[model samples]
Target: MRITEPYTIFLRRLPSGKSVYYYQFRDEDGKRSPAYSTGTNKIAQARRVCQRLYNEGKFKKSNEILFKTFASGFFDDESDFCKWKEVNGSSLAKSTIASYKRLLENQILPFFGSMKLKKINTDTVKRWIVWCSEKCSAKTSNNAQSVFNIIMKSAKEKKLISEVPSSELAFRKIKKKERELLTVEELNRIYHSPLWGWECARRAFLTCAITGMRIGEITGLQTFEVGDDRLNVEHTLHPKFGLGPTKTRVCRFVPIPKSLGLKRQCGKTWAFEKPTEEKPCRADYIYGKLMLICDSLGIDHKARGITVHSLRNMFISYMRGSSFGETIDLKIKAVVGHADESMTDWYTYWKPEMFPEIYEIQEKLFKEITEV
Candidate 1:
């Protein structure tokens, strides 16, 4: 009945009157190994020996579990493994969990699932990478490898392995593609066009273009978060995950122009409420309107891979191209909530009133979009 990590220990006596501790271990599947003696008469000494052997990976039977069995329900939100991960302070977002599950089910599990946990080594991983390279893009192979690393680390935590085999492995290089950004002239074309309908979609697109907010951030923006000449970006609306913290999980204050006229309706909380609807505008609807506007103006949006997210690119590029020079560097990062910036608190201090230059630039941009 005595239980310890990696093994359950019990005492047994021989005919010669000497007592020794026997230990039994279980695999990831909960199948127990046969009892083996610790050859120690003292329980305290026996427990230490058991721990030492466990640390050294002497419980070979536990490592015999198949990789697929070991990874079962690992990415499932309700699984014991996932719950354990949360309790251990590594809780993942719902969207992240879903992505891990996709990688596991589609890539990692299929390659290593039949192999024993002990059999997965550097050679095996390299072979899997080779197989993945032939079957998918480098980006997908890279993601699959990352998910594989997580599983192996979890196995190491459970003492199933002494170390993660993929630790020294290198990922495939990914080719970076530049995201398309709309030009100032193009923005003017869309805004000034009488053909453009969908008032909510246009407002949201304008907000994104001016502030570099992601489509999700634009949708999640509330009336209360809007100030006289600034918007507090505290949340993002995911179609699948609904309302969540900003992508960086850090709130940012983006300077806006009062001329943009973003306001809350009497019964609406969303800054960009859809016509009579109480909910925020859908990202797809906004994207559709953008593409249509581009088509009516003879802009090849599809050829240039323009999407709603392109507005963010447009905002960053426009700010960088502006005459303000280096003074506006940190302000752009803060407005976009760049996760890697360590001076987020410092950047947040650039309030709309304090930095009239930002409003000046935004007002100029707004005038271009609204005026002929």
Candidate 2:
């Protein structure tokens, strides 16, 4: 039966050892529901429950009704997304999930949370792209966009939305910058700097310099991944994407100089290792240490445009100046784990200790520029 107003009355004892006391009312949909007041059996408590039910009714409705009331229902099914997150959370690393959570909470949810899934148009998605571009780098904007697209794709699969907005239409073109390289002087400064106390930082830097492996690949290397004085570039521990395949999704081995028997923790073969929980020997750690060294050397680390990746470039350059010139392609490809050999052919390779020849060429080039 429909009750027009909120009120309460105590009923005689039922089969159970309790008396029924509650206010009954029809919601906005004209469906009957009850508001219970157990202990007091009081009208005031019943009315409070009724008020709460009414407030809840304001937002609880079909997708259309929700859109009309809240301007969006995209977040209405957020619990489902939360469930998905929890499931994926277990399979992935904490940092990976954290990054995804940041994108969902800070970027995607803010824009489309309340909007009905079907109502989200390309225009709105484009606006999000513009907003991301204004606030973040192109790479970051693209990553955020990717997360949004993934959600929309899931919604489409679930029939929550008939169509997913085309994300390519919202894409912003980003210019690629040249890779930075450090000069020999800067390298020497870093090697000698006292700021780098953690031996791993120095070793990892030199490893990257000689091996040309990406930071993630270098850091993620387990003892088993190395063999015969060679580093096997196979896996990477991405900051946001978690442990997975390298960018090429291919593994290659990099030969190391036999002169250096870099060993940390006896019987451990991992090229880089740190004391458990004491500190991480990751590329970021090494990069930070390098920055500290740069600061101590009075160098503008930021303006100088040097990065850990520069070590790889130095390796490529050094290889080109060596005697084994034609072998550059195979060596660089093996060291850097390049999937495409054409890209690897860009650099010339020379012998390992041809510093004199390289300096002679450099000197001649400098003289030409100076004389002119």
Candidate 3:
């Protein structure tokens, strides 16, 4: 049923098969949008709830202010945190939302769920931090604290809490391991190694080394997007987020070495199929594969901090070490899709005509690859 008198209303069925009546209204900016839901399927009940919500100025609250209950509403399908389909909505990457939920369920919610939002303060969170430090890495603990901050901020935004208490209790800095890059010779060994006898892995590994695209980009590359001298580095494929925005939320066109050739479709398929078939290179699989080959070749991965990403670092290292040095430096950044101010904003203007000198260095770099 449609109600288009003072506002617009539509009966929408969620993925869960439950139908809810959603209303569209003009926000402060004078733009029409879906602001909230009626949370019921029966027409008469839905209309009554909608009327009540509107009478209360479209903001509803329960008598009790439990952390668990507020969190549920904050992440409701209509809100931005976990929403995927709303237009002009500020949503986090799906994996991030999932992690927040998981963190709450596993750690934060268990401790704070029954308590009121105002009752959770820095001291309460510090206890959780201490507990997390005993079991998790600095990175993971930091993630939980971040989610906690978001919950507090959201509570304040929704008028659930009068103020956020000690909200600056961000976790301590995390000391990340240095990523050791692979030398040209070491990279060449893996390039030549028959360990990646499978065509998909072989093509994918070579692509990563030469172009320096992220694993997400490499796995998301399509046949139509590959060109003679460039690649449309547009999308990323995350296991949890599925296909969404690139890491930078901007599209980049990366230059490739002419010598780094693909069989028309380097990274087209979404996932792995039979081992013999052409499929998108899985990041975790490639990480393990690189480690396996390194072990077999007597290369010290842990000591060197070498991983699949090291190939991208290797490409950057090659560019920095090349004779073209002072000149074509921005070109190098543009070639690798780096967000460098020295180059064009879109990084799309680097035709071979603009920097003919970089092609020679790229050729020399690619010459080191002993393709499988």
Query: lDDT tens digits, residues 1-372, model 3?
Result: 954444456799899988888776553344565456765677787677556544534333322457776676455555544553355555566665677778877767777778767677778778878888887888887887777777788778767677676476766778977877787788889877777756677667877887778888887776777777777877888976667767666676776666666535444453222265555657787777788889989999999988788788877777777776657667677666666583456545545567566666667767877633
Q: Candidate 2 lDDT (Cα, whole model)?
A: 0.60
Choose the strongest candidate by TM-score.
Answer: 1
Instruction: Give per-residue CA lDDT, model 2, range 37-127, as digits (tens).
Output: 3333555664564565455443233333222233222233233454555577533344554666677777766667667756777887888
Best by lDDT: 1
Residue 91 lDDT (model 1): 69
Runs in model 2 lying further than 4 Å from the true structure: 1-94, 178-180, 234-252, 263-270, 274-284, 316-334, 337-372
What TM-score, computed on C-alpha atoms, does each candidate reach? 0.79, 0.59, 0.73
The CA-based lDDT of model 3 is what?
0.69
Predicted candidate 1 versus true structure: per-residue lDDT over 85-161, tens digit per residue:
77996666677788889989898888898899988899999999999999889998999899999889988987788
Clashing pairs in 2: 72-114, 72-115, 320-348, 322-350, 322-351, 323-350, 323-351, 324-350, 324-351, 325-349
In model 1, the clashing pairs are none
